[model samples]
Target: MSRRRQRVGALAAGSVVVCALGAPVAFAAPATTSEITGNGAWVAQAYENTATGIYLTPQQSDVEGPARAPFGSGSHRMVIGESTVQTELYRTPKYDGTPLADITRLEYSTFARRTNGAGALRQPTFLRLNVDKDGDGDQDEQLFFFPANNTDQQAVANGVWQHWVVTGSGLLNVGGDAGAGSATTLAAYKTANPAAELINNDDPADGTATTADGGSIALITGGGNGGGTDSQANGEYFVDRVVVGLDGVDTLFDLGPAAAVQTVATSGATVTPSNLQGWYHEAYDAVDYLDSNQAFVDGPGATPAGGGALRFALSTTTNPDRVELFRTTQFDGTLVRDLRTLKFSTFQRATGANTTPQQPVYLRLSVDTNGDGGMDDTLFYAPANNGTVAQSTWQSWDAASGVWGVNGDQGNGSVTLAEYVVAHPDAVIVKNAYQDRPGGGVAFLVGASGASQMNGEYFLDDVTIGSVDAATGRTSSAKRFDLDSVAPAVSVGDARVLEGNSGTVLNFPVALSRAVPRAVAVDFATVAGTATAGQDFTAASGILTIPAGANSGSITVKVASDKVREPHEALSVKLTARDYGTLGKAVGAGSILNDDTKVALELGKAAKHRVEASVKTKAPVAKATVKLFRVVKGKNVRVLKDELSKKGRLSTVLDEQFEKGTKVKLFAKVRTPHGVYVSETVRHTVR
Candidate 1:
């Protein structure tokens, strides 16, 4: 007997309404240009005929009369003997509604976990999407099936869940090797001589898909080798979220604060990983747990609309001793490099052992920016500079003032988050600092984190990074402090001069600590050493003006020269800070090179069939090596060496005989305390 496919209605449109802290969670609404479609997560249907009890939970199993709970927090369908279930969307479903005519593309993203008995298992799940080409109720001719594999035995039956997406153009694609693709089309299945199942790349679960007159699609997840045995045992499944787009937003999972803890405690239960679902934590100096009762979180909105939230030890404390995601590398920092803002929600409470009246519940943003495999660059949204989070209230960090903080070393010497966003727009390897002074050279979740290896606790949720435009609600005028109005730290620039050349302009570079809002200037003065002022070089003093938002500027020093050959001399320049900011280190050094033409060339024939180099200096040549060179094809080739006559003169002969009128180029070289100096090249035709 042919089993008639049963039709199940689409579930509710929105998810459980939850509070952000003080207000409602405004899920990242689709920007004005686009639309959004989300079927409340964990609300799909399940059906089966097996004797094994069916359940409505996403956990391995729930104690809350889970079997009869209808729809669990992370819900899924229970499958038995070729039984089927439905996946719905708000207005975007082409299953039962008019096919979107503007369907330039179709995309699907969802999270599913398998639930099956120990019985021998074959692939037992599949998703069938349909489109009604005409107004006719049936979409049978327009259905496509994507089979899901349940090959991992360890995760079988209420096992680990995985995120999946389908890119539908002409073919259904998973985009990566993990998702299997099928060559078998809907048309191919109907034409097989014996009507073979069109399993495609997905292992054949022998499951079939069909559409009803209303264009509603259903999945007939397969049955056993032959119905009558446990080998064809029933299969159960769970779906946490399903999103479809005409153009819509993707779902994101924030770790805590409003994150409902699935573990219900036995009275007085201590913090432990065994009691956690969808979370990874560490505890000490504070007790962290999923308290089913509202009082435990004490702070407002302690309960998720769904009835549980992960709680930490405080509303405020210098010690963050707390909870974090499973591991550090879990997030790729570069994902937000281009974004100007990172937004998230959190709940705070001045309860338990942390009764400090402070309202801030904060966390730092750490990214593996250096890629040495650790989050070295840390940005802190300091509560003192950043506003304190209200107790029991939900707040949004729009990358606006209160949200952008300083570097992890606690702001002593690091760029602000806002500053980094402007500077490192291509950074990757970012994560929230999971441990204190997290050490270098460790995997995202592995070894060497400092003292923070086990300290700090807080609740947070809804983390998202966006660009300035995406966060239109945020504005530059909103910075917490008037950074532009105040003066910032500055470093003086240095200059160098050439005593022999005089008239050389030496440049000094002045660096500012942070960008400021207004144009500002710094005063500089040169203090002479062995070099005199005005005589060797004019003394200089003036303001180096820097424009608004500019971090550095330059100044120039003029150098004068006279007839003198001396050692290099250096002068120190001091930069005094302007009224607006405090001064940091302020001294720079300049050098004067004393390069003079000390050697005189009197080229003459040694009268012994060789060329000669007679070198003379203004003073007696002292401890200097005199050398001779002959030009060959435009290049100077060393020809001979000679000792200077103590009276500051030398003449040398060529080692090689030259042809008549070879037209060789000659020059005299001398070594000075300053450096080796060479005289002007003199050409002498072979005499």
Candidate 2:
């Protein structure tokens, strides 16, 4: 005889209920839909004796009694047969109230082997989760799986392995319960059933456990005995730890940082918020809070019945070039509001020294009052160049016919009222407003453009519609530039001969109008009657020192020797100032010189018996001519050759050679366009 024992009761939470066979009483609920929020809460209540009926189909039709038990405490045996079983529990919405719509998911995996020395042959067995709706006995919905095999089990001798999978709806399926292998397999009973969620759970030899968190039950088998008997008759399978909820909600269901929620109390008044709400999800769609770039409607407290006001203070390193406010209904797609506009302020220098002065800044307001995203009204203030404010109103876009106007009059200041009507077709009444201090304010809209003024040092207080307005007072408009104002001045001092009497030393004082000085340059004359512009003079402790003995006083300072210099030409030196707030035009006086003409060269030669002469010049030297004469018996004899080239240099081979102990004289005459300058006669001896 076979003995059976059963226990029936609710395990814990209101999630699962179980009943013993042939018992009138049944367990109600152990886990509820709301209590299964955390992990491990539903594990104890998952398994129960819930099967309704079981049918077995053997592989061989002529097989007799049940197969012998190869590894078990009892005499029950197993047979090689296909089986189909149905559970009594009616699958609903799991633990959550959200309906489990479709099971578009399934899977299977495990380790197994044959018992009769021959490899086990897998026959398909379907596992299905049936739902009985409308109190009908027939299942209205079912998640089924077709037969699956474990052909990879031949590698290990009943080794352990694990495998699992997840569906599109986040369902997890795991299979690894039978310890090793038996006749346990999974199959889908329905062929045309809608797609359902399923996954495999097979344990590996590495000792890692696989879980089936949100899927249906798993199928596993016990390992066969060495005596060719199936040992899967009395083994128990475990199905624990299940969860169901919205995707990504398990981590982010709490309210974000506490936000200040305020209400508006005026009509026809613009309302702005202090803090902006970022992107968020509400139900199936994402949403975002209001932006500062859009026109707003007052809630309930302005002149009209439905108006309110809001204000925000902002600061940035760069000036507030522009600011815009916008409102929208959807967060993912285009904005719902048809009107989009921007208002901005321009800045200018106000006060301070020319090198480091303060600048004054002003604001300009423009708007596209109509639905189109184009500017219809423009107002500008010139703080630096222009002394007055400018206003313009123009009509261009047509919302009705979708045609734009070409000749619309754009008026300035008071005359702009007539143009405002055509410009902002959607605006009932357009008005420009200005506030100077705490309570003093004026309306400057349309014809009142010049009436609204904010002068002197005043804060831009709140622009509210009612008594409950939040306005902050402006303190000062003073700003300064980070620069030096005074221009740099350089002077060339007197020259002192440091090395030889022929060498010259130059000195000068470089004074800066401002305490902060940048750089300076100096130049010197060369001995070859030319300016050597390759030399550089660097500033050290606000002073540039040049050695007087270098290159024999042929060194001159190269001014402005930056990378972009002309080939051999030197840069001209000048005293100039830069980076001053309002003093960029200021400069100091400095001295420069053209001292190349002051240098002289001397040459010497050995005394000789016969004489010859030659002369050369770099620049064109006008002259009467070159003459070579010899002294014979105290009487001078003139040579036959006498010629002058365009250049100053002259060479002459003597026609007659002088006798030993004879003296020779060579003279050169240089003539300018004005007059002729004679050179001292030079005499050379010929060997």
Candidate 3:
């Protein structure tokens, strides 16, 4: 099958690239759509060649099985970078009109084979992306460091597929193996640098000097220093499905194929009644009550209409034996303090011909206002007014009316139910203790006073506690609304970065879906990305107030300054949700690009007999390899080399031949995770 096509200029969004077999494709979108024919690939640039080891193929082998093509259908891409994948020239425009800086995530499939023979360590292949993420000329270098001896390395290297989604600032080796492989599924990995920032970048090769033009994607074997020494780049590896998100991506495009959403779904603060809180019952001369689930009771078509219901039954006990269900622990002075009305649904029936109904049925709610050993306030519902009833049936209560029967049906001590609710608004404890016989703690079946053992059956459903509304002075809705437990949405502006030594203020906005009657305060903290707290920027934590009826509020986070010359860095400000509304995950990114003039070690004649070399880097470096070479016919021939001292300083005595001033020169190379940085060769005669 012959597949040849002519292409000119930079690759466009819809430019189709024909593959030798299977399909033809473009780089605009995911290959899931049928419009993209054949396989996974884009028309590579004419200048790109496999001989230099930067081989990028859309698909390696289109096998018809799940074992291959883990991306989607057809073939997945294969990217082999033997230290020659240019990072500056790959910056092409996209369909969404998105630039690389707006990207959030990049994901791709990669695998490495275990080395043979003893001490067979898995060869570490550095996978990274987001080259020049800040749109600055310099590339923010992040290394996905794979441990040489991971426990799951064999399985991953043994044909088991793995995927990585890169994000985070300077995602340069945040640590650990990307992930282990699974037989039935493709292993997942986070290829994004979480702490990626323009700050604390230790490598100068990642600076402007190395950019092809201004931007490009970089994937290479081993960590190439751009001056040879890419030893780790020689290993055999399988990499396909190249993806990159400028910041964070979801639909997968300019963002890498498998990157997760840029922002996480937000949630509001919530207070829900945990199950097993208590639907309790006790036996006093009474064996078992409803005995339905041996816990509470269940019935059909009850009250507020949810599903089923709970029925309360009593055995033939002494007239007024009393049992109760307490709202203990649940009423621990938080969202609910002084509840106005304790609503409930109940059904009373008369058995056979005993039309007397069961007198004195008393249901009461008490509040421990002062936490003083006993309940200081009480509200009781007495159905004794209606006296007795005839037939047995189901009916709704405490729903629309917010009361058991009628108003004025409750009283405790001269204070009526309405007055008690207003008095103890801050009660610490509330209980449902229907005084059975009137002692310190009365007997069970207090409602069935002087009646037969089984006075028919009384059923209760949808028992709720309605608190007094702060604005309306009464319970707003009978159902007490589920408190709208949905999590709140959160967003932080993208432009909150520190420019140089200006010490800009990083502000995070906190907003709510609907205006709350009461003010909601959220806490904010400094989260480290590539930038570290105390070192790169100042660490801060405080409250952000969203006043009543206000949609948004701001938290002003203070950024710091330093004299260290480094690459552009990133920092994140996090917001914490408290009592009122849900706390959302709104992170404000802080970028700190170097504003000071960066200086590298200069090697040249310092004295009449000795050559002195000195340097100042992004951070402290150790054991730097310094080379002193003699210029022989324009070729650099090594004469002698030594490592720099702790202060990043080097001094050496030149060869006897150089003592005569042949215009000899020397250069220094600093090894870093991104790659080795070669200094500009200094030409000077040494004695």
Candidate 4:
């Protein structure tokens, strides 16, 4: 029969409790939204079957007996007539079992009874399996069948119920019979008939027997009279010791209502927990773990509520020597909503250990706000380990004083205003820190509220929370890198000056302690000197090099323009250093422009000169060679050697060289490669 067609009924004292009779059964309570966020724990009720055992009274249709022990119910009893019974099963949150996969084996023990002088009553039984395979809250597969034992049996006597039962297990065949004797092993049964049907039994004789296997079978009942009398009720069957085998096991982390748990494994690597809310770091020291346990409560009711202790086991080979804890919490105590806590416990171990120590591990606790997976608030406690006792009470932040402080009181501490503002400028104050110390135990309390409390990012690293030195008594803050130690220095050498000239070199000196990726620019400006339109003085090279770790270097400056006449002009040479670091910041000097002196000159009158002339010829003289000569102080002097022409003419300036009233004689000579030619003497007088 189909799963929807199966029905289950409970035979109570003079009453029948019908559970799933072609209807949906609700075994678990509906989950609420608040419970889903806070507690994350829920479970379904247990399912009971009452119609599969012996009857207490012959006249009564229902069976009742001694109370059951395991689940705190009554004795094993069932109705004695032909009827249909159904029971509803539910899913539980904390059961240590696996999800039902393929069916492995189904075995149950039952006792049959034939009564009322009947010619061996015949009864056929059916079983149904239900599952929400599609996640649609409905049963998917149904497995139903009749037993193979529906045959004739000899009754012990008439008008009395005789017991004839099958207590051993066996596989159900397609025809609903004990498939080739009784089933002794699950693997053998599964291998025999891969598509076996449900087991059912029908006996024609009035027989009664007790069955020990009661927990395996889901539902069992009897119907269909044997003698074809349409009596509708005759024989009865009792079931017990029902055992079903299935696949994997379930973990406790899957207890929440719609909660999902993911497992990850790594070797020789640091583990960082991510995508968490309302908590700080997932690792902590031992002392901090104890402190947080005292300060915070699990859920609203606080009794058998949601939160509980979290445990972690290290590998056998890990022998940790030291450990630390980290957490994330809101800096400001305001914005209490969306608050979460993450606890981390770490241990340091030896290099070549095969087994770890049994005791002495560190623990810590942290709180996260804004949901950024980082802890904004953290608490630390150092527990007694290896016979060492802890002396400090508790460590927390002081927002008012803007520092971390210690509190000795056991009650919850107050909010720290100043420190909170520095860490979270936009946060609002909600709750403060509180601690409890009794019986040599320490606890720290933290509370707060603000807008979007469940939003933001937070993180934690390995460090102390609020410990201060006894001598100094100063709190510590986070560390960060000085940009003010970089400057530039420059120097200019002596300027070379040339009279009435330009284009001179001016040298410069630069010093640096290290090599830098930077560009140096040098510019020359006229300070006081003026240059003529035609004269040009310019900077020859604008870039300079400072070798790596070099103390000093020289740069040449060119003067392309001339200085003016008035006051001596000066040229300003500016050197700019770009991209300087700490060493460069030490020097603050720039380009220096200075002046050099220059002088002017004047022109004088013209002087007189003398001239004589001569000429030589290679071929016959086709033309005459005239010689031009000058005389000084009545002495003859030659200026021009000769003048070659068809006819020669000569003139000389003798008066300019001689005094007034002086007479002079001028002569000339001409020669060729073949011979020589001489001209007659000429006389000139100066007056």
Candidate 5:
């Protein structure tokens, strides 16, 4: 149908005219309540054969379902770049030929914004109804419902959603011989032109139903050649949850994208910047980490809570103008007054010889204070302006609590959050107009033109924001974003111990590459190689826990000692790490050394009555001493005692006054740095 109208003013000369000639896509067949199911559509039609430049698309950005529209997953957006031409989205309804008195409720939700240059033009899309005034077969009269005509100027603020009801409101009529100069309410208009009946046309595809043949309702925006200069102005508008009540039943039309969960929600969600998903950054230089604007980095100067942090940089030579890092597709049109808290940890360092402690970037919010598409002002939370900033150390900012500087009115150096709210009550985060990038709703920026020392590197982590319910005023849990790159890798070190007479402990060191905020646990079990579980060492199996904020811990295994001389035994402790971490050196090898000693004693054949003895052990003997005794009358008597050689060998002959069948006993005692060792006693008889 013809969905456009001309204003009640002189037509401007040199006007650009556009015409839509293709076959229009048919809307869903009319029912009790007609709804725009999938990506809702809009087509251009001319008033007096002329149309404006209109752009319509479903918003693809992350928008909270039901919270924004109270019905749909997304919203349909329409932009009017040029004025003086009218465009609209229309639907054919089943309530055609019904009386105007039968209509009960006619309302829809709208979000409208203007550009930077458009001044004092705050009107959004208007609703139109085709009516048959004289009960004739043709529908000749057009009824227009303007939201600006009913609501106050404050309710028309930019970036805020508003619901308007037009069923019982006044409407302007521009019909045959009824000049557009006069405006009257629906009651007065129906009284003036009695017997007004709705018109119905079943065929929408044949292009036969014109504006005069009324079976259609349309949501229209954009100005025409008439009505004052302000009537034809540029604007961006969104409409959703269109409700039409006929007779007694109400039909709700859910508009916009299909119902599905996106990657991130508008609010009450967390994001760890391991990748660039749902984030926007501009590349400026050849340096990979710094140029990409957002990078994942680790080590000492990175994340204070361990793992990795999100990195961004500003340069004096490459990007000397301005640089900003922001969420790619999140937080658009979020009200500033609804925010409860905003915080994040930052590690700052400069690239030049400047050693003064400073932060490279500050928090910046591009706000639409006047409901325009351009940035009306910027709210800056700078560390230098609020408090002290440290270099090469992680520092957190209470962004929501700080006094922000307002850059809109030539710099209000200290504007409290409460004061800003009172002045710009409907201010919201928006995608600011920029030549080089699609600036995000919320972001961190370095205005290098103003701040000369902004040439530095910065690391951001643990970014969190809390929101409060506008109706209830209750705060919600903070949505935390931990910009982590990788998990910590755990490893175990080998250990060695000497087996003693009593129990000894073998300590295996377990360590992580970096410290984290949460405690890390790994299960470990001792595996036997040559050492038996109970005989050689105590079998140990349990979860080894590394405390939060600590990098190292030890696992102890008890070693059982004995006097038996044997080879060294080996065992291993294997580690299995849990989630949020990985294994590095999975197994730790352990060795248990033997500590027992051995000695030998024999008689020498070169000399008569000569005795030789030697001592040997895993440990070197410091000194050795041998003793010789003789048994007489069933009593032992000491005969000789002498020190042995360095090799622990002793050889000595008995005194001359020895007789046959004489009983003698010899034994050797050896001393080492560890302890003393004694050999078994030997019995010999002189022949």
Candidate 6:
């Protein structure tokens, strides 16, 4: 079928939802904007088929699922039906106007079911390329690849995902007036059609576009409307991770819902939750997995609302260890009776040794009910005891409504937060530390006992806590902590200074990606380069401590300078911090620019025909070769050249006879490992 003939207007307003490959057909609530679009570079335009809505959907298989989840937490689902030519075309102008000769690879992944049905033999979609042959303003050719027609494509079934290559041999076939036959390869197509250029309908109103406001490469599915096998196909297909290769660079489009699309955080970045925002991590006697754990990850059901979730690990195998994330001063003295919302999201994986899956961390609140200066009441909400826990997916719990266990109120029937608050109306969060116990605060605790939980990893995110006014039933404020795995990365900035005659300090600024609760110490030392330490610069090595809650520090090194005309020199400063933070760009470069500029060549009176030549600069010349040359036949011919005079001065006597007014040039050259340093040509007369 000719896809170009079916081009139409905007997509119809509606929504379509589908389950993953093997899952049963279930209707989901309409997708929000966040779940349908991610990158603004792409747009969906429908033709022939009646699409409720053409956008990205979060309903996708996990990373370990049948489909290769590439960019985000979802994929681009195209709803096809009995329509003769149903097409939900996704386009991007990013590669528009690119010549076919520069394209090296074109690939995409699609999910399809392998069952005996009307669309069993039909491929996912046709990879179409709108071409402007002969460089005209109008699109004249449509080159496309039908995976069903290409024998090189994978023939596996069983309801899984597969990849299709559209640039290699036996892939692309020309359509329309270009004739109908396999183009074999992109290179061959470009050779035969030398004027082939990718033309996209990226902007219809622009009047200059050969296509529309869409894009170049169109992901088309559902061709020809009919109940038969060749035309209409009754199936839903998912397209994701479209890779477009142009001029040796590949750009991937991670198709997913819009609101849920977020910038995935760096895995092990140690981020200190902000205190001003009512969240912070307190330093406890636990091993901080700054480099060993992930702070952000993506998968189906990995994160609750977005493409990223927090992954952290705690251990009870050794000493008591748990992450002590706390809210600063906002909840210090708040009465537990006013607490309204308390909930968090977690992802628990299946356990091999036990039938029941591992439990998530606990939500604890240190309360003082007896009016004592210390916190005597500890209330905990355990996931294993309160809610229905599951494995290998994300789930949330309303800790406030669930059962809560107090220090002395732990029986078979643990009371809820509402019941405990009603009994102890005076119970308030303690704000002072007492007897090694952190006073009156909320925290997530795990791993103090039990082998079943020992050495197990856990993921936590979207922690929310709020208070309500009982009289008005109004929520005063809700605080949510976005727990992430990113740790602070330490790096040093480059420094430059003039090589002074004396000690000159070169300050190199050290920075961290984020501040931490504990002081960070980084060891640094100057390494020798073109400039030697203790000679050109002072050798320094020591620990630089970045105080807690600070993100920057500096290191100073004294550089020595001799006032002699020489080329600029450089040295390296290396940093190492194994216990504090991860090293980003560990080494900083130092440049010592030459500042001395004075250079002179003096001619003195001599009794013999010999003429004296000496070179001098701001400082005493040392081991410099002096050369004397006189113009001969328009070219300066070398007459005398040697190191220094016997008296240890940059002086040489020219014995060659010359006219009194003859103009000769004196040159001085100094050789070093870096490069040769030569003075400006000093013209002197041989009087």
Quantify all predictions' global Cα lDDT against the true fold.
Answer: 0.41, 0.25, 0.39, 0.28, 0.59, 0.59
Candidate 2: C-alpha lDDT = 0.25
Tens-digit lDDT track for model 5 on 353-450? 65544454567677777677556666666666556777788888888877665552112245556446544446777776344455576776543323
Best by lDDT: 5
Q: Residue by residue across 246-272, what tens digits does model 1's lDDT show? A: 333222211101223232222111112
Candidate 1: worst-modelled 10 consecutive residues by lDDT? 15-24
- Candidate 4 stretches greater than 4 Å from native: 1-503, 513-536, 539-545, 561-567, 581-687
Arrange candidates by lDDT, descending: 5, 6, 1, 3, 4, 2
Summed over model 3, clashes come to 57
lDDT of 4 by residue, 1-687 (tens): 112223222111111111111122222111111111111222111212243423222222212212111111111233344332122211122211122334433433333445454554334233333323344433333333234432223222322222222212322333223433432333443354354332212111123543212221233343333233523245443332232323211111111122222212211111122222223322112222222221121111111111111222232222121121122342233231111122222112222332322221222223333335333343222222112321111112212222121111111222222222222222222222222211111112111101111111111112222221112212222210001112234344444444233345555455544333232233323332353212334534345555433446665545543333234344444445433322333222223232322111111112343322233332224354444444467676655554454433333332335555455565555533223344445554444
Top TM-score hit:
5
Q: Candidate 6: deviation at residue 405, Å?
A: 9.2
Residues 574-659, candidate 3: write the lDDT tens digits.
77666544545567666765544333656556555566555544454556665555557789787666775776555555544435
- Per-residue accuracy of model 2 over 280-390 as CA lDDT, tens digit each: 111000111112322222211111111122111122221121122221111111111111211112221212222222222222233334434433333222222222322
Q: What is the TM-score of each candidate against the true structure?
A: 0.27, 0.19, 0.25, 0.21, 0.42, 0.31
Q: What are the root-mean-square deviations of the candidates from the true structure over C-alphas?
A: 25.5, 27.9, 42.0, 30.2, 18.7, 27.4
Model 6 agreement with the true structure over 477-540: per-residue lDDT tens digits: 5666655434468899999998766667789999988776456678999988899887888999
| Candidate 5 to native Cα RMSD, angstroms | 18.7
Those runs of model 1 whose alpha carbons end farther than 4 Å from true positions after fitting are 1-73, 81-119, 122-124, 134-142, 148-158, 168-232, 249-687
Residue 411 in model 2: lDDT: 17
